[model samples]
Target: MLVSEVMLQQTPVTRVLPIWQEWMDRWPTPAALAAEPAGEAVRAWGRLGYPRRALRLYAAAAAITADHDGVVPDSFDGLLTLPGVGTYTAAAVAAFAYGRRATVVDTNIRRVQARVISGSALPAPTLSAAEMRLAAALLPEEGAQSAKWNAAVMELGALVCTARAPKCGNCPIRSECAWLAAGQPAPSYVAKGQPWAGTDRQVRGAVMGVLRATRMPIQRELFFAPVPELGDDGLDGTTFSESLRSQLRRLHSLMAPESQLERAIEGLLQDGLAQSREGGLLLPD
Candidate 1:
């Protein structure tokens, strides 16, 4: 779960659930994931935005297998040592899996903390020592109960105390919330948002999606391959050739910068998401 959290940062939960299930089912144990080729791990990552997380997860799996006998470590320090396991993930795993009392602060938790404790719409750029101290002060004395409380607070922020428009009336903590008491002061900080369309990231994602959806390797030439020779098209070869060229142009526009796309393609081949075989591109079995 902790590993999944790290991979899923800034990604939508709807997309993360299926990937997480597929990953855990295939690996099941850390040792199982460790035994697979690193390339296989990358291929399994599919269209998750950050490809590097796949590599980190593979490394973390290996560390768990070699050092901890495949059991995910229970201590905060131990979890922190795993690749891609940051402070948030380490604390979350320790609290949730090991029943330790720790403040698991993510965006959701930060929102709740900011609104209720500080009467703000959002928090500082990063979690600070003061924020940690304040959160820790609120943790329940019992370890197990503290974990449950932490989860509850985060869940509330996700479902109700949303960043855009919090439903103050139904909030369990509304009566005591500083922000609510102060009439929900306006957000002091602007939310950082990234555009989606026409970005290289989007194009890269589309390329990966195409690879994953295919059963056989696609040809590098066929990337814009003439519509799979549509059975006896009434239009004939001349018209088809013109259409193919147009389609290729459109696809080229949608892909990454020429050099970047070439590199991404090469990386995919190296990672086993793609393979070059006898003048064709293919997904590995």
Candidate 2:
């Protein structure tokens, strides 16, 4: 449950499924995972996007093995103490894994809550105290029933009451949906997709990609990948052949500025995702 929750965060299920199965097969128990080096977890993360979650999971495993006798915590508070666990994750683990009643709100549940109770097209960008109180109050009194309620509401939002192109006719609570009664007003704020192309995240991921491909320390220049010094006779682009220009563009696309590369490596070192090794860089051991 912990692994699935962590893997599912901001990642599509199709992308997470196989890697998750591999992880479970490799480390069925917290102690089993804890026995491996932290770098192994990052190596096995395999394009899950946020590799930090891998390190956090590794840390969480070590914590569980050391502090909880190698068992995943059963209580919401106990789960919250895990390295990457937050309020929603804690409540989700308690409710879904242990069948304990909790205010298990996530994006889907929040969306459902907004449309059903608040008569809004969407929930706020961040979770609010009012949303928390409402979710808590809406939970069923019985633990098992509340757990089911959480799953049902979240699934409804995911499948039928989706943020875009909701299947209103299929929604079980369509008649009671406040947003429907209010004539399905548009969201007050515009939704935006996260930027990705050429961002620091791309540079960082590219650097990590190279590091993940090998166990050996990587020379820093590989990331900076500076173009060979154009000498005094430096042929300008206009003087170069078409093929040369094409190759130059391809090479340029693979390189980052020295400053950005340094910043990325420094940030990785600070995050414990990387370490200096023999005058080069490598993932943490």
Candidate 3:
């Protein structure tokens, strides 16, 4: 479950379920996953957004095999000591796997808690120590049932009290919800997101899609082929340079004009996907 939770980071659970099952089927235990090549894991990742989580999971599995005898740690501190494990993962494993009374808060749990308990329409951007303490307070008294309670709250938040359009009338906790009691206060902050269409992220996803789907890197021209459509919707000849600038241009042309395409490219470089050498853009091995 820890492995699935980490893999599901920034991803919808519905999308991660099949991939998670496939991974566990292929590598039933930590020792089995540890023996496989990290590249194989990344290949199996299949467009789950942040690809590095695949690598991190590989590393964590190997670490567990080497240091912990292939067992997922039972303690929150022990889980936290593992690679890629954080507060949420640690608490989640403790609560769900070990049946500890730890407070487990994800986006769903957080939003539900904020709206139902805190009387806020939305949660703070990030979890705080005080918020954790508050979540701990809401845990059912029985340690054995704590995990079920946590899961129930999170499920309620995800299915009924969703961010965009909450169905308060159908909510199981609607009667006790603080926000509903307060007449459904308006959200305080603006919903923020980079538009998907014609954005650098879209181009990057396209580029990564092309690269990951194939065994080898493709030529620069293959990506920057001319498009009949004008504006950011189409790739133009000017973006076909074999240089880094052209690589950036191809992504920029696809992205919204306001997007930070250059910075996103730099992030890819830092992650070792695209490299600049001999005045040409190339994918890393």
Candidate 4:
């Protein structure tokens, strides 16, 4: 449950399903993961956008093994102390894993609350104290029931009260919805979409891909090669230099600027996801 919650942060359930299953099959316990290199976790993470979560999960596993005797912490506060485990994750693990009553207010739940209780098309960009209070108030007094309600409300928002096009007709409480009662006002704030192509994230993913594809360290020159103006036709593996240059050019064109690439590499190193060794880059040991 903890691993799924962590993986599902920004990624959709469909994307996380196979990866989560594979991860569990590989490392069934925190101790199993802790015994492996942190890089293994990053490699196992595959294309799950936000690779930092992999490193954090590795660190969390090590902490659990060393401090908590390889057992996942049950209490919210205890779970919070784990690396990468934030308020929402801690609360989610507590409620879902241990059957504790937690105010689990994800984006879906927030949207559901906004439309059903506050009469808004969308929630505030950030969670407000009032929203937290309302979420806590809405949770059932009984622990088991509140946990079920938490999941149901989140599902309701995801399936029916979606941010883009809400299916009010299928909504169970559509008639009683505050937004419906108020004639469904448009959102006051304009939500900005995140840029993908040509962004640092794309570049970082490309870099990580190169690292994951090979066990040996990649040369620094290959990492910084500029994008070629034209495609290489005679770039055969027999000519090592030309082939490497051509490959690097292809990678460079897909990546961000050299400075951004360097920054991304540095960030990965700082986050313990990658290592610098002998003028080459490698996944951490």
In candidate 3, what residue range of length 10 has the lowest lDDT sum? 233-242
TM-scores vs. true structure, each candidate: 0.77, 0.90, 0.78, 0.91
Q: Arrange candidates by TM-score, highest first: which order? A: 4, 2, 3, 1
TM-score of 1: 0.77
Give the distance in Å from residue 234's predicted Cα in candidate 4 to where it truly belongs.
Answer: 15
What is the alpha-carbon RMSD of candidate 1 to the true structure? 5.5
Instruction: Output the lDDT of residue 44, model 4.
Output: 95
The residue pairs in collision within model 4 are none
Q: lDDT by residue for model 3 over 107-158, one digit each (tens)?
A: 8888998898899999987678878888888899998899899989888888
TM-score of 4: 0.91
Give the poorly placed runs of model 4, Cα more than 4 Å off: 226-250
Assess each prediction's global lDDT (C-alpha) against the native.
Answer: 0.75, 0.84, 0.74, 0.85
Between candidates 3 and 4, the lDDT winner:
4
Clashes of 1: 5
Residue 222 of model 2, lDDT score: 45
Against the hidden true structure, what lDDT does model 2 obtain? Answer: 0.84
In candidate 1, list every pair of residues with a backbone clash.
217-281, 217-282, 218-281, 219-281, 222-225
Question: Using lDDT as the measure, what is the rank order of every candidate, best first?
Answer: 4, 2, 1, 3
Please provide, for model 2 over 22-135, each residue's C-alpha lDDT reduced to its tens digit, 9 standing for 90 to 100.
Answer: 999999999999999899999999779899999999999999999999999999999999998999889989999999998898999999999999999999998999999999
